[model samples]
Target: MASRILAISGGKGGTGKSTVAVNLAILLAENYDLVMADLDVEDPNDHILLGVQLQNEKPINIMLPFVRYDDCIKCGVCGEVCDTGAMLISPNGLPYVIPRLCSGCMSCYFACPTKAIVRGERTIGYTYETLVQLDGRSFRLVTGVLREGEEHTPPAVIAAKERALLTDGDFYLIDTSAGTSNSVATAMDGSKLVLAVTEPTPLGLHDLELILQLTSKMGIETWVIMNRSGLGPEDEHDRVVRNYGSRIVARIPYSKRIVESYVKGRPIVLLDPSSKEASMFRELASMVKEVME
Candidate 1:
């Protein structure tokens, strides 16, 4: 059977999206086979929060334009077709490729009439598959880590998601990066449901709307999770979610225990299953299980 994907995303940073994802995965794995894919290549920390090292690293390679200077035809077509300005024509009438600026779109490759652009390889990131055993059950964790100084993230995100999907599982939970970039969209593609985590602050409210809009357009069922609920007024947050035709499904109140558990690299669900935060995760897992059935 194909895996049912559930995406956990947040439009703004520091919204506890990963925390929700890790905890829910642990709870869900108890009843069903689950594979969690951490697609936040820019700053992936799901493995960190799960307290497991990433294993089985595989490099993600993309097409890097290698100009065959010997072919020697600089018609400026390569530079003109470059969308990211990665292709530059020097004063000497030669096309130079800026490795960092290239998005690997390969627009210049086909546009070059001289056929000087040859296909080369560049390593932008790596993907890892780790087996996380907690309690008596185990789930696979696929993580994507972008190479330092690499700006392109969509490739790495897609790579990680694909790696997770290859495994046989009943549920495929994806943890996306903060924000509504193409990278995030790539990570959330083909999800059965999306849980958008947000706080009550003004900044959180602002980005929550962006994520809701993206999910709405994708025609995915979305549920808002109010994290740190008592920090600020949620009148506007509630209004915005309702406007998007979605409702808040869970609320994780501010608590010092959650903070300490996070600091110690232990999820509240595992640290103290009897805690309020752990109960919230259990309730969320129940709702997700209903959807799965």
Candidate 2:
């Protein structure tokens, strides 16, 4: 089996990237061993959509400030060495460290003259891996959850991808966050192909362009999925997208049954792969397999 990594990303939120990724993983798992990674560390929803309980969640740690006050002369060296403004020097000549602003570069601790700064660990996120069996076939699901108020999603996303790679599966489907930020880039770095999920709305087309630009810059092959295709008669957006050299591999039509089944945590493909939406997705998956082969 060949290693094939597919990253599902969109530049904007509510574009159904996770939905496409999850369903694609479930469908592909029928013929290939699948490792599905939820790299949307900021707010992972793949597990929620799959209705699978995430077990063995291990906390992911980040380096934080550990101050040694005993050896202290009130030196501001740590504050001056910090670039993120995580460390602050008080008017009274005391130094304070804000963990939130810290990037864990350890520059402050390295530059501290009094050796008063030390590295400490903070729980920035958690990662979990589980197996979901559908139709007598089991697929692996790995996800990372970044603690709210933390800003280091890129690392967590990378960690989750690394964990997924350990599954040694033939197919790896990565569900990325909704943005073209560093986190999305990190999640998409090593993908063999990327499928950008979008709706037929103006906002969806707008972000699809942004994500396409990102993928172009990265030299990654990309395809678009125009979800909710019948929501409106805006064919111009689709035309504009194709003009940019990316093709729409699938168009999932808007259906109340799809929405309700999604709310109930069921994969649309499983409900009926012969349905209009699922058939389109299957066609998309077939195209993906052809590309990989």
Candidate 3:
């Protein structure tokens, strides 16, 4: 059978999206084979939070344009047509490239009349794969890490997602970056469902609609997981979710146990299966199983 993907995402950061993803992955892995991928390329810390070292590193490289200075012509066309401003025409009429500014869209390469542009590669980030286990049951974790100072993240997200697909699993859970940017969309794309994690604060409520709008457009099954639920007014959050045609599937209350478990790199579900948070994850996993069925 093909893998069923569940995307854990939200527009606000610090909402415990990764925590939910990791714990839920542990719970789900017990029954269904699981591969959890962290697509938050700008700052991926799932391995850190899970307290496991990332292994099997694969480079995610982007195209960079190298100018051949020896070429006879110093046309400014490449500079003018460049979308990311990576190509620049010097005062001496020679075209040079700023590698960091490049988006690798290849517009400058096609626009160069002198054929002076040579394709080069720059490592934007890396994709890593590792195995984690709960009891005897094990699941794979694929993480995307963007190199420091890299601004473009969509390529890294795509690369990590593709690597995750290479693994065998009955289900795939993707943890996406905050906000509804192109990078988030890229990571959450093709999900069987998007389980959005959010807080009950006004900021969380405010950003909730943005992600809903994106998922609603994609026509994916959507669920809201209110992380730190009951910390603030949930009525507004519910109203916003109902307006978007999604329902609240689960709520995790604020607790110090969760904090300590996160800091200790142990999933709450594994720490205390009888705990409310652990049970909540099991409940969520059951719902996912039903959906897949």
RMSD (Å) per prediction: 1.1, 2.2, 1.5
Best by lDDT: 1
Candidate 1: where are CA atoms >4 Å away?
A: 1-3
Clash pairs (backbone) in predicted model 2: none
lDDT of 1 by residue, 184-229 (tens): 9998889999999999998899999999999999999999999999
Error of 3 at 185 (Å): 0.3
List runs of model 2 lying over 4 Å from the truth: 70-77
Q: Residue-wise lDDT of candidate 2 within 1-293, one digit each (tens)?
A: 23688889985758778878877888788778888999888888998888889977888877887888786577788887888899888887777888888877789878888888777988888889999987676899999998889986766887788888887788888899997898898888888899988887778878888888899899998888888788876587668677778888787788876787688898788776677878777877788888876
Per-residue lDDT tens digits for candidate 3, residues 178-290, read 98999998888888889998999988987788899999998888999999987888999999999998999998899888998987888788777799888888889998989
Query: Lowest-lDDT window of 10 residues in candidate 1?
Result: 1-10
Cα RMSD, model 2? 2.2
Question: Which lDDT value does model 1 have at 57?
Answer: 93
lDDT agreement with native, every candidate: 0.92, 0.83, 0.87
TM-score: model 3 vs. ground truth: 0.96
Candidate with best TM-score: 1
Off by over 4 Å in 3: 1-3
